[model samples]
Target chain A: MKIKGKTWKFGSNVNTDDIIPARYLNTIDEKELAKHCMESLDINFSKNVKRGDIIVADENFGCGSSREHAPIAIKGCGVSAVVAKSFARIFLRNSINIGLPLIEIEQTDKIKNGDEIEIDFENGILTNLSNNQSFHFSKYPEFLQNIIKNGGLMKWTAKKYIK
Target chain B: MTITEKILANHCGQKEVVPGQFIEADVDLVLANDITGPIAIEEFEKIGAKKIFSPEKIVLVPDHFTPCKDIKSAELVKILRNFARKYGVRFYEIGKVGIEHALLPEEGLTLPGQLIIGADSHTCTYGAIGAFSTGVGSTDAAAAMISGKVWLKIPSTIRFIYYGKLNKYVGGKDLILWTIGKIGVDGALYKSMEFTGETIKTLPMDDRFTMCNMAIEAGAKNGIIEPDEITFSYFKNTLNNNIQNLKSDSDAKYEKTIEIDVSKIQPQVSAPHLPSNAKDVGEYKNVKIDQVVIGSCTNGRLSDLKKAAEILKGKKVNSQVRCIIIPATQKIYKQAVDEGLFDIFLESGCVIGPPTCGPCLGGHMGVLGKGETAISTTNRNFIGRMGDTKSFVYLANPEVAAASAIKGEICHPEEIK
Candidate 1:
């Protein structure tokens, strides 16, 4: 359970509305939503973001709106993971339910934009490839880890509740 | 235990629940709107669930882009309509539907001591009636639709007690803005805000709804007031005889307690970009405005309109400002018409819109352009919330919004005379 990618940085209180504006919320198509991912904050995000890239941000990322579109857009745009100082409650749950891995690290400022980083989900270790620095984040609880391991709540619930 | 804990524990079939403990609670009511309903239904189908756990328990409202702003939105609404019809789910059509939060309580769908979940964050609005209602995302809503249950981490309680009488221009909106300013946006993150005190008890049900509606602006799980006579009377004809009077226990523990003197408080305004960036209205007396919007689940009730009408009657809006008024629900819209508030608005040069969530989320009806400024009665003054990213929004009570429209700048209601 490890992920490696270049990082894109955002400031604190990055609201969901900026992640995906309300106008584009009419459709549930992940690809369509991905086209506008982070367009408000960075117009070139969807165009330049590569698969397995990472997004690192300051505190209270994904703050406004309960729209799951924010995480869906981020995940659909081929970002592997999002590491932030903290997340709004609903955003954290939505990301987990949708199988988008989110890590909370206190020293997010240490990771600069475009820095190559690797995250070890099992060991809670974050290695900055460019700088050779290491940081640690708390591991998820057992149940939450299982949900992530199962790839999302939908798959987890399907396996557990359905025959 | 606090009232929120009591409700969650009751639904979870537990003797007691503590903060930070994950619990799966039975949902008595579930809600989704047009914007989130299509996505939730798609996820619900992906789970391979044949039918909803309970058709009657689920409520769908298409208020966000109602009347179908575009072909895509129309198609989205069609998806919801077809699903609702096939599954026998309760659906409120355009004319019947308003803001989901306001419609639920007005229709008596939300009850005290009930655990309710919605796809929209403002769903916390129902906590005004003592219901343990909170917001979740589309996938969470989809899971709830299938299983009739959702997982929630028990949140600690933060109690706020208000005393003394409110000033003439001050109301629930001012109180909430003041609170949000005192506590930063994340001050109550993942915590239940239980409001109590003489001022709250005497406040009208509409004001209570206004107060609870903005709890999410402070990142609160829910904002609630114990059911009082005003709340009971609002539900008197609809509620059953066995209604519960849920309240916090005398020995209940709280993470924090805040006491506010209502009499000493002034009409507050949350400035641009953050609801927590609040200031006394006197501080921004001459901040010019380009638009004035008075509606949304927050501050769009009949009382809000009446206040605005009182300020706008026999007066016209300034030539430089665009004033838009939207009633929260159809019932409120009809009542405003019956009370001649619509005439006052039209004569005052305000554009009266149907019951919809127009322009509040920058969706439609009165979106601001670049470099514009608006004084809005709705909550959440986040950057680009009303329109362009460069546009500015100042949040205030309905009275201040109306007065600003007339003056084309931020002004207190008392200054209108």
Candidate 2:
């Protein structure tokens, strides 16, 4: 499967609290959370972000809290996928469990905000459509592939446990 | 195998396990709090599972935003209360609840050689007692609740051996802060931090908890101390006669080993934005603060209160500084009151509150506004962590928090004169 979107660039050590502030944690609704996504770091994020926009960030993206709201809000706000140099462990798991695609690539500095990019997940290739430069990331393992194919862990669990 | 490895291998029914191996392990306990619980419950419902795998093994606490910060928070806790009733799980109410890390261990729930998972990042605190515990996301909690199992990738170990005698002001909070300062926040990412040494052997139970609690700050999967006589003594009254503790084998492999000399270390204070920005408290002299908070899952224990009260006794909090002291759990609160620590806090113009995680997560009770600064014992001074994004936070131990309250500025306890 292929994903295409313009980029929203961020810096190193971008934490979950910066993704969605604790003040907005009162709700579990993705729509409500989406309204405040990245309000603390970039207050204009939610207001300006369009659906299917990709996030390109430096290392340690989504550090700190284990609150899944960070991923939920980003996904809810129509950020199609996140590509970072690295990710905090819990945030990575949450995004995967919720079926929000994440890519880890070296040299994220070359990517800039509003730079259109295209990803071929099945083939593990990402091309910055703006510059026509391509990068590669490790392919997802078989089990992860199954989870993504099932649309998330919730649906995967449902298919397994629900009669 | 290391103690962490032993626990993880035991849970997965593996005779031997190595780092980087993926295993489906059975969890002895699954935890979620008010913030994560409602979301996990939502996922659990979506799964349409037959029933909770083991209701008795599920623990829910509403400490993050307790006593209902607002309508939405109340609705969130209401969902937790209703779910607890439906499933017969152990739930802590606002009055009885404390920070999940302090509350669980105080109630004797955390034990050695158990595989525990929680939906809060600080869940790694349980590793202090020799349990293989780590934080997960909400949906992972839901998945564990349904099957009593979790998927895990074993992490290699990083051994931190601390020696030398500690100074009066230095304690677990400072040691952990120094470690984080030494290794950047992501230094130990996806690694287990195995803390051992002459200094750790003499460290108090509360300090051990404090050290392990911040492992996540260093990007560690967990921080653990080998269960020894001290660990056994901690659980002597709480656990039944069957006590089998695990330790790392003599030749246990570690990805890296670090040695910290405690004698030369000073009380540390993590500056704003990142825990890795830690330094000696003397580096931040005369840095005035608007508030002083001496509580949270981190340093809100009885001993922490005692340290704060020791410094605050016969002194008054600066008129400009609003000092908020919260005991982590009901039992700890009662103990502090019984020990007259509450009177000292109140006499010093400090406000003592219930067993809520208030103000720690910037949830409620005393949140900061724009451009305000605070010196707190709570962990994590991230941007907007305790209020407005423009606000600043400095992290220190209970002694520093109390002493800073008296001066309205960041200063050493010895400098209070």
Candidate 3:
């Protein structure tokens, strides 16, 4: 599926705490998590986000703690794609394993905030509508791509193993 | 080949290994805490193994569910305790021990140059003592338990070379926080951080441990400070000399090299929401605080307590703010009590919590309310981490944390003491 949205820009090291605080981990539900997304940075993040929006951030976008809820919260909030200079290893693995699209763009600073963006995972193209710029990342492995298309590891595992 | 490749090659008996190549190695040890043990036990049952792979290699600790705050967590820990006993696993219950990572290395359970896995992500803390450790899921942990082997992709290695000694008030925690700020969080993802420098060598074993404990926060697989005389000395009493024999080769290669000057460093704090989001502790000067915490695997060691005690001796905590101190483990707890650190803490109006990861994990204790601000020694300070979604947690070293306890504001140690 393709995704289009306006980008919300953040600086380096937007950690898990910014997404879902540790105190909020008492609940395991995703819908409850979406309300706390970026609560550490923008106090009113949950109230302001639009559907199918994108997040553009600097290096190490998800760091500190291995809570998978960070990505679940972002995805539950209808964030389509996360384009960062880099991501924490566990966060990247958790995101991809859970079917949230993450792109590592080397020149992240060039893309301005609030730019209209569209990403075609099948075509490996990331388009900036405001600047008329398009970039591409390496295609994901076939196995990983299948998992993403099926929507996260739990569903993919159930589909692949249970069936 | 990169240094990470070389180290993994050496472990797997290969000359070199590429990034994508996966290989299984002989397992050395497996650790699990109460929170993750029950889940792993369920997965371990799936393999239909009648017994554990090896009892001597298994370590089960009941740290997270200490004091058994609730019925469900108590039941879970009880199940794990029974499982540990039935399987002949080494078990450490509350009042018997504290944190598994702090006690394991000191009790001779962890050795240098061994492959260790734990269900908890902070398992990377063991890498401080030179073991190649990583965190795994319950299924993965169960797989390792079933066959005594687990798969690994050789990670890239980053070399942190130091040139100078730390100045006054700067310790290993400051150095790590500074590095995290410079590299950001994801800079070392799935990489082995090999800390090498004359300055690193001079640090006390506990200080090295404090630095290594937070390596996982940087998203690293492990943090390796090459074992030296200090490392050997720390273990000499509990383990034999032969245990420290394993060492990296002299001509090891590295993918990247980062040089840090420790002498010019000062006390630092990680602002609300991120460990890598660091700024000087003095940046938020004159801001009042509602709470102060001085405990966590990152800075709950004896030295950290001693340093905090030095500042709190004959002093009292600010009447406005509440301060809580939790020792890292029972060993540290006893030593602190024996040395009268607890008296100073109590005399200063700082409350003492059980030796568990309480406020750090936000499981219980020292929780904040809406709009309340706290300076804590724990790793993360994300919004709503300590109490309410509106509450803020600021991460700092123990000295800065203790100073803030007295001032009731975010004050650095240099400013107070």
Candidate 4:
């Protein structure tokens, strides 16, 4: 699987609160959460984020709070993928469980906001469409790959237990 | 194996488990708060789970957005109320509810050597009692609720030893803040933090809970202190059966070991936007504060309230400061009232709120306005954590928070005179 999108750059330690503040956590509706996604960093984020856009960040892209709303809001806001120098542990688990693709780039200095990039999920390659530079990340384990492909843990567990 | 490894292996029925191994582990307890409970319940239904795996093993505490911040939060809580009723899970209603992390151990629902999972990050707070508890997302929580098992990654262990005696005013909150300042926020990412040494050996259970609660602040999967006589004594009144003494083997492998000297340390206060941005309290004495919040999963226990009351026993809260104190549970609140701590708080111009996680996550009850600054005992001082984005939060222990409230600025406890 491959994804291509324009990048929205963020700095290190973009916490769960910044991704989606606690005030908006009253509802389980993904769209309601999406409407306020990343508003702390950019007030107009959800309004301006185009469909299939990607997010790139420095390090520890999702830190603070174990609320899965952070990833759900990101996904709901029309983000195709996220590339970061590193991901927080809980955030990584939540994103995979929610079927959101995350990539790790050692140094994100070269990736600029509004720069277009393409990701090859199977091959673990991220190509900067603007500069044509390619970087490689470690591929997910087979089990995790299947879980994400099956569209998160709920459906995956349902396939095995719901029958 | 380390303590964390031993607990995980035992739960998964594995003879041995190493770092980076994925195993399906059984949970002794599963926890969720109102905010995450609704989402987990929704996913639980989507997966068509008929009955809960173990009704007795599940815990629901509606503390986060509790006391009904608004109609939206009330609706969200109704979902948790319904789910708990349907499953017969242990649910703490509004009056009976405390912070989930504090309430569980207080009620002896979480014990040593158990593998517990929760949908809230602070669930790692249970590690103080030697349990292997960690936080997961809502979907994972829903799955665990159905099967009483979930996937776990055996993380490497980072051992921290604090040898020196703590200063009079310094406590677990100070020690943990100093440790986080020494090691950046992500230093322990995906690692288990094993706290040991003479300082921890005699530390009270409340302070131990305070330290373990902030393990996630340093990005640790869990923070634990091996169960000893102190731990056993805390449980002596609650359980008839003896808790086994659990500790890491001498030959256990650790990712790294750090030694901290609390004797030489002073009270610390973390600055805005990051818990790692810590500084000695004296540096910020000139920075006046608007409010002081003295409760949460981190430091809302009896000892914390007593300490806050001790400093504010006779002195009044500053005219410029609004001090809000909350006991973590109804039992604690009643104890405080019985002990006259409530009179001390009331006479000092402080208002006591119900046992809710109010204002900690900017939920409500004492939300800060623009340009306001507060010294809070609750964890997390991220931008806009306690209020508007322009508001600032300084993280400190309850004593420091109380003194700051009396002085209307960031002042050390000793400076109150």
Give candidate 2 misplaced runs (Cα > 4 Å).
B237-245
Question: Which stretches of candidate 1 lie above 4 Å from their native place?
Answer: B237-245
lDDT of 2 by residue, B1-417 (tens): 888888898999889899988888999999999999999999998767758889999999998888888999999999999999999999998678888999999887888878899999999998888899999999999988887888788999999999999999899999999999999889888889999999999899999999999999999899999877788788875554444548888888888999999998999999998998899999996798999999999999999999999999999999999999999999999999999998999999999878787797788999999999999998899999999999999999999999999998999999885
Stretches of candidate 3 off by over 4 Å are: A1-14, A18-20, A24-61, A68-85, A94-135, A140-163, B1-7, B18-21, B38-52, B75-79, B82-91, B237-248, B282-284, B414-417
True contacts kept of 4: 0.68
Q: Considering DockQ, which of the candidate structures 2 and 4 is the better prediction for this target? A: 2
lDDT of 4 by residue, B1-417 (tens): 899999999999998899999888999999999999899999998777897888999998899988989999999889989888888998988778998888999888998899999999999999999999998999999988877888878999999999988888899899899898888889898999999999999999999999999999989899999988788788885543434536788899999999988888899999998999888998884888999999999999999999999999999999999999989998999999999999999999999999999899999999999999999998899988998999999999999999999999998999997
What tens-digit string does per-residue lDDT give for candidate 4 at A1-163? 8999999999998999999999888888999999999988999999999999999998888889989999999999999989999888899999998888889889688899999999998788999999999999888877787787788888877776565
Quality of candidate 3's docking, in CAPRI categories?
Answer: acceptable
Q: DockQ for all models, in order?
A: 0.71, 0.80, 0.24, 0.77
Candidate 1 chain B: worst 10 consecutive residues by lDDT?
A: B236-245
Q: What's the distance in Å from true for residue B215, model 1? A: 1.1
Candidate 4 segments whose C-alpha is farther than 4 A from its true place: B237-245
- In model 2, the Cα lDDT at residue A66 comes to 97
Candidate 1 lDDT tens digits, B1-417: 999999999999999999989888899999999988988999888778887889999999999988788899899899889999999999999889988888898888998888999999999999998899999998888888887888889999999999998998899999999998998888788899999999999999888888988898888899999887787798875566544548888999899999999898888888988998888888895799999999999999999999999999999999999999999999999999999999999999999998889799988898889999999999888878888888899999999999999988998888888
